[model samples]
Target: MQINRLFEMVYLLLNKKSITARELAERFEVSTRTIYRDLDILSSAGIPIYTSQGKGGGISLMDNFILNKSVFSEEEKNEILYALQSLSIAQSPESEKVLAKLNGFFDHKRSNWIEADLTPWGSGKDSQSSFSKLKEAILNRRVICFEYFNAMGESRGRTVEPLKLTFKVYAWYLQGYCRTRNAYRTFKIARMSDIVLTEEHFEEREIQGGLTMEDDETSLLSLRLNVTADSAFRVFDDFSETDIQRMDDGSFSISVKLPESNWLIGYLLSYGDSMTVMEPKHIRERLREQAEQIAARYQ
Candidate 1:
């Protein structure tokens, strides 16, 4: 906290040309004696800070002082600003303040190079609220409770010690220790609801590694599909360019390995008649049966 105060103090003096020790003390909620001590520390650290007792004289940095430009190269300064700019996506006010100060201190204008939004398309405010709450719980090392829905569509109440928030495979997931199951589990954010940040605090656990998506390679099925030209946009959207082969007729052939599951069948059905399963006879059969069931319901 003192380091933060010291850094902000330097920025303030740099911007205002002169500020009273009383002003710095009030700004940082410290005593004037503490502010004087900080001034000493800054001076000892090779900062050109001095104070004059006369009227209109307070704490000031030498007029020639610019945060030693040689300490960070031009590119390094831009990179630092860009990194802080990215944190703006989370709407962190502290980061925004620090970013502004650093921008002025470095005397560099940051360009709008990138934009990121974590909320998915069509998602309402609840999604953003849940993300913010989970982030808070993680930072404070507090337990969280929520209703979670699994792939089978079963809903259950869960009390978890949230460890990390991750984004992978086009979705956000919370990796946490599930008190209900007594083990570590990853819960999809969209499948979570009624989240409550519990008062219970937790100690940091020795997590082995980052979130891992475990799949049995031996059980995976190599899927190949012939997508008509009408679904060309989707083909490129969902599959990598290396996996897609453009056909002479403008249609595309794609090959990928995926686990055979009801979810896979449902995904194929989403393409409707625009896609045909060219291999794996069992998947094709499964798709046909699913289609027939839908038709029966309509009839």
Candidate 2:
């Protein structure tokens, strides 16, 4: 705690330029003697801190002094600031305050090198609340309950001890221990609703490895597809450039491996007429059947 107080004292001095010992004492709820001791500690540690007894000056750092010189290399300082900046995506107020203070302490201007927002397009307040609550639950080791929809669109209540929140591929997922199934499971955040943070807490568990979108590794499928120029945006967004070949007609040919799941057909169908599967006869037949079902519904 004293170390924290000492760091804050230096931060305060850096920003305020000059403040009396009595002021810091009151702020830290300690005596002016303790403040003087802290100042002495700082001075002995090669911090160019000095106190003045005149009417104007109380305490000040040397005009040319920089904290980075004593504590961190230039690269280390930038890395720390960049990490804190990245954490801004979480919308943490405490991180923001520490970020600002470090920026001032390092005398470095914060650069807008990276911006990250996990909130999806057209998502509402409930989405943000869920994300924040999940983060809190994960950090605090609290159990969470939510209505989760499986790939087949069947919804059921789940009580889970959330371990981690991860963004893989195009979506966010919560990896947790499911109490109902008595196993570790990963749930897509988008399909989760009615999320509740419970007062129950659990000891952290050792995570089993080999987690994947599909539990059956044998279900992985290799496919080749022809994408029209009209779907160029999605082609570039979803596939690596190396995996895509430019055709003579401005269409693209892509070869990629993906997990075979109930939603796989639906995902391919989302490309509509702009894409066609060239390989995998079974998938093509399934897609055609699904299309016929949709047509019958409309008819």
Candidate 3:
């Protein structure tokens, strides 16, 4: 931890030019004595850290000192830039600023080591706008209200304490405390409309284990699907190589784990006659009934 603190102290000096011992202590949540000791450690390590004890004086790095590229190995620097660039994909202005600052620190030109555009094709403009608003609300601890449409096609107004914006499976979701439901809910950004950010701030609540930012890997249902050759392109696009197998008839069999929900049913239906549920009689029956209903309507 001390080693991390020392690195942070150097970064702070590099960014802020100078800071008071009291300020450093408060920033790191350590005592002035501890700050002084860390300064001694930096100075001994030839970091060019110096402190002046007078009015308008504070701890500062030498004006000529530039961070050596060796401090961050080339791979490590690339990783940091890659992370910032990924954040920028969400259209985050702050991420762009920090990314530029970090590049400047290393005296490196912008490198296209990685590019991440998480939005699906034809889905960027709206998703980026929603992500920006949700990110702002989360950072400012503001309450947000939006009209949410559920899978059942019901629309309702929701007031939530925006907690986190997550990018999962090529879509953005807002996980927050829903005042209407009296529980934490994950609202898909695509289904949200009429976004309103309230000026009222909210104190952070202790998050439940199930409702944290991490994705739930449990509760997965194993599904078997038979895909016709006509839809094999769609199959390859959606499924990983390991989850699919080619049959002698030129069809494809896909066995995958997915969260069992209405969304799963809808996703299967979207594939139409080109795909069939090979197992799980209940799911197959449900799909068959839905198809029969549609046929009856046409008849």
* Highest-scoring model, lDDT: 2
- Stretches of model 3 off by over 4 angstroms after superposition: 1-69, 212-225, 236-269, 277-299
Number of backbone collisions per candidate:
0, 0, 0
Query: Taking the tens digit of each residue's C-alpha lDDT, what string does model 3 give over 123-242?
Result: 757766666778789978999999987665567899999887777755678888988777777887778888988999999875565563212322567889999998887987899999
lDDT of 3: 0.81
- For candidate 3, what is the TM-score? 0.64
Q: What is the lDDT of residue 225 in candidate 3?
A: 94
Best by TM-score: 1
The C-alpha local distance difference test score for the whole of candidate 2 amounts to 0.86
Supply candidate 1's per-residue lDDT for 171: 84
- lDDT at position 67, candidate 3: 78
Q: Is candidate 1 or candidate 2 better by lDDT?
A: 2
TM-score of 2: 0.69
Model 3 clash tally, residue pairs: 0
Angstrom error at residue 150, model 3: 1.1
For model 3, the run of ten residues with the poorest summed lDDT:
210-219
Minimum summed lDDT over a 10-residue window in model 2 is located at 210-219
